[model samples]
Target: MANNSLLEIKRSLEPHVGAKVLLRANGGRRKTIERTGVLEETYPSVFIVKLDQEQHAFKRVSYSYADILTESVEVTVCNDEGQVRIEYLQQ
Candidate 1:
């Protein structure tokens, strides 16, 4: 995408900075950024997501806007303490 387009998309996504977001990888599976907010970074122009809790299964990850195509996303929460669960919701 072009810089102007990215900027526009970034501006539209600004409100979601402090909001929860679901990241979908190349596979069909998805990951959730818990309790944290969104952050903009320069190196790759992606969203920096912080982890609210210590995710035993996965670490904190940054999500690129390009990777997240839709507002509707799936959230997965799992840990050694409990069972793994999944949720699908709209952003």
Candidate 2:
């Protein structure tokens, strides 16, 4: 049942592939890592973010949809107008 719910969230994000997004993830011990990237790809259980490397080396990060659902990770997609579209995956 939980898998089905996750699939729904994944589907909702499919159209945002290639869109610019800000990713915030908890790194444990009160640390948080934030990055700006393009929504590179989405899979059955996870989505990848291709990070901007202007200030550092290029990197790609993946986070499960479940993480969003649980608020463990936060993603904010930016539209062409420069407005932020936030997705709050309900529990």
Candidate 3:
């Protein structure tokens, strides 16, 4: 049952590689971090986001589909004009 949902989540994101995305994630200890990046790649268990150079020191971050399912992270995909497409796991 759990595996099916993970597969569903992965399928939802596959078409959006290379799109712009806004990410909100729990930083632990009651902190939240937000970032804008291009959706770099998606794999069976994880997806990577390449951060905008001005806002973060790290070049990239990866999150598992379970993180979204559990609501610990949020991903909002955007169009070229920067409008919101879909939001999930909005922590």
TM-score leader: 3
Which pairs clash in model 1?
Answer: 17-38
Which of candidates 2 and 3 is the stronger one according to TM-score?
Answer: 3
**Clash counts for all predictions:** 1, 0, 0
- Which residue pairs come into collision in candidate 2? none
**Superposition TM-score, candidate 3 onto the true structure:** 0.87
Residues 1-91 of candidate 1 have per-residue lDDT tens digits of 4555545555555544454443434443465433432233323366566554544343456655444444333233333455222321233
The top-ranked prediction according to lDDT is 3
Model 3 score (lDDT):
0.86
Residue pairs with colliding backbones in model 3 are none
lDDT for each residue of candidate 2 in 1-91, tens digit (9 for 90 to 100): 8887787878878989999998888989999988899999999899999999894376888999888888788888889777565455456
lDDT of 3 by residue, 1-91 (tens): 7788778888888889999999989999999999999999999999999999998999999999998888788888888667654334332
Poorest 10 consecutive residues by lDDT, candidate 1: 82-91
Arrange candidates by TM-score, descending: 3, 2, 1
CA lDDT scores, all candidates in order: 0.44, 0.84, 0.86
